[model samples]
Target: MLSTNPFALSDTRAPLYFSDKVALVTGGASGIGMATAELLAREGARVVIADRCRDDGEELAARLRHEYGQALFVETDVGCASSVQALVGRTLLEYGRIDCAINNAGLSETPVDLIDASGEQWERLMAVNLRGVWLSMQHQIRAMLDAGRGAIVNVSSRTGLVGKPRLAIYTASKHGVLGLTRSAAIDYAPHGIRINAVCPGLIHTPFVEQKFGDGLPELARTMNPLGRIGRPEEVAECIAWLCSDAASFVVGVSLPVDGGAVA
Candidate 1:
């Protein structure tokens, strides 16, 4: 039902569909997470940015609060059960409820062939990308159940639905994210909680730079049918819509925000 271009952030006066909502975004210090946090705050949601990057987290929170006055940053390692618990507890204590959550804290390993991928590296990627989402969803769903309404957007990737060479661990972890999103949606939809995922193509963000470096620009331009990589804000828009009332009927779906890359 969201007819407006979900990839464009040009509509400045667009409605604050999330006004009064208390939203939380993990891995909110940079890339799509940060862009999503900024957009949510601009839409009048009180946002809690949870990330392990202390300085960037604080700086982003400060910038949002100074500009919008409804942003808070909490240092969190989503992979840790204790840290995740404290994150949910603190958010409730500070804001009284959690209306939405975006679990985006994830890392990619250096490219390695399937046979070359080490057990430790695979486990490490799983710990953060898969287990982290599981923990965050467990707590967020608990909070939302008490309040009787909520939405969750897991930051998945195009690689989740398609295999890519030399990225064994990362692809496996992302595929797990898709599985989690579907299962959680089925379990919580009756409870008024919606769970979905955004599988983005290459996007211009710090994370992409870390993963692909100078080659990313060229990669993005020619990677898909659209002939370009995506921007962080473009991915953020899809996430924002999935979190909004406009996407009320959308649930348990892995919507691809790719530039026709998976097609």
Candidate 2:
């Protein structure tokens, strides 16, 4: 069991839980993904940041290597099978093994009635949010299976647990993520691999700020029991714990890091 409460952190100082391990974080250029990468690196893990944003990804990887430890940035479009495969291959080429993976690359569509949603938009969202996770897991699980041990945390959303008006496609995609987590967990548990999902509430990420603007805080207050928005670091802490030995007994759980929003 984890001795310290993950939610009570006041700073970034964490135990070296992932020392010498290699962690792969998709969508690691910004927001929740970036925070998770930073946390893992700080805890002594060599990190590979895979994302489509070349500049941001490269910058983050450089910062991590200079300030923390070994880090690499691989330009990846998770929706593309080739890109995801190269990402895994590159990680192995550089680091030799993958011990942890955070499938955090996802996108959200503008809120619109189901009837008003376009087939193109829905397909686009599914490609990255749903298929992306599945593809990443396929390769990640293969590597972990070879090593006989590993952990995975897929980033879902609060919307995955409940229906939200005007977010039909996004909700469906996230729900799919949870389903994948559970089924994969069952299949891989005996193989020494753990798979789980983190359903985050209205986290205050750059993407959220751009989407919600000045009303973001108020909207978060109205939506969650905590009456405020969550920080990226807050969500990152949950992801880190789920990937660590502290959560060895935990598997296939969709943890809600949402400030009681779902409750």
Candidate 3:
């Protein structure tokens, strides 16, 4: 059973303003994706949790079923065009329409020197972190177009907006994400779909811990001006709001959920 009290309720079921909407969160198995899925479910949206990790994705979906009874797990490799198309197809088949999508599935810092980075690494990162978003948006927007309304939040990194040393491929992929977000936002707003990107700073998630080290959370926390790394729930809150009607006017925005990291 999903705990009723998660220490971050935010005023009782988050106003239930999202009732009846369908949401698909890529990378919905762990970290920021998991957090966003839980929040969306709590807000009364039927959620499709898609990820490459079937074990974790199925487990999370089952838990959500036990809690909210409106979650589905779809095994997806966003890097593959066919897989992304199938994901959207399944979502529409199950839910009738998609109201929102969070393209949160991404890769960690493959910290390689720019000059030393091979074409293979570059292509690999682009396939998932960049091309994945493109393919997802392609299929997702097609469905939303038929419905005539939807929203999209692509999970970008602070590095996407700026640059981070030693992770050339990752950085380039993020930059591509922002470009995609902006272009799609402009092209889709006419169809009643809004496209935006969320740029998150260092957050306390399993990915971060594994990438940096067990003690990396402490390091990330202190590196920020706020003296603490961000939490998954914090990023989730931003996504939930962006996916909600409350942000209807928001489009083509690259909102940074960083703690003064850009400053």
Best-matching candidate per TM-score: 2
Better by TM-score, candidate 2 or 1: 2
Report the CA-based lDDT of candidate 3 relative to the real structure: 0.90
Q: Which 10-residue window of candidate 2 scores lowest in summed lDDT?
A: 6-15
For model 1, state the Cα shift of residue 242 in Å.
Answer: 0.5
After superposing candidate 3 on the true structure, give the runs of residues whose Cα lies further than 4 Å from its correct spot: 1-15, 214-218
- After best superposition, candidate 2 residue 168: deviation in angstroms? 0.6
lDDT, candidate 1, 1-263, per-residue tens: 35475333445555356878999999999999999999898888899999999999999999999987788999998989999999999999999999999999998778887898788998899989999999999999999999999999999899999999999889989999999999999999999999999998888887677878878777877899988888888888889999998899999999898999999
The digit string of per-residue lDDT tens for model 2 on 96-130 reads 99999999999988999999999998999999999
Candidate 1, which segments miss by more than 4 Å at Cα? 1-15
lDDT: which is higher, 1 or 3? 1
> Quick one: best lDDT, which candidate?
2
RMSD, one per candidate, in order:
2.6, 2.6, 3.5
Stretches of candidate 2 exceeding 4 Å from the true structure: 1-15
Per-prediction TM-score to the true structure, in the order listed: 0.94, 0.95, 0.93
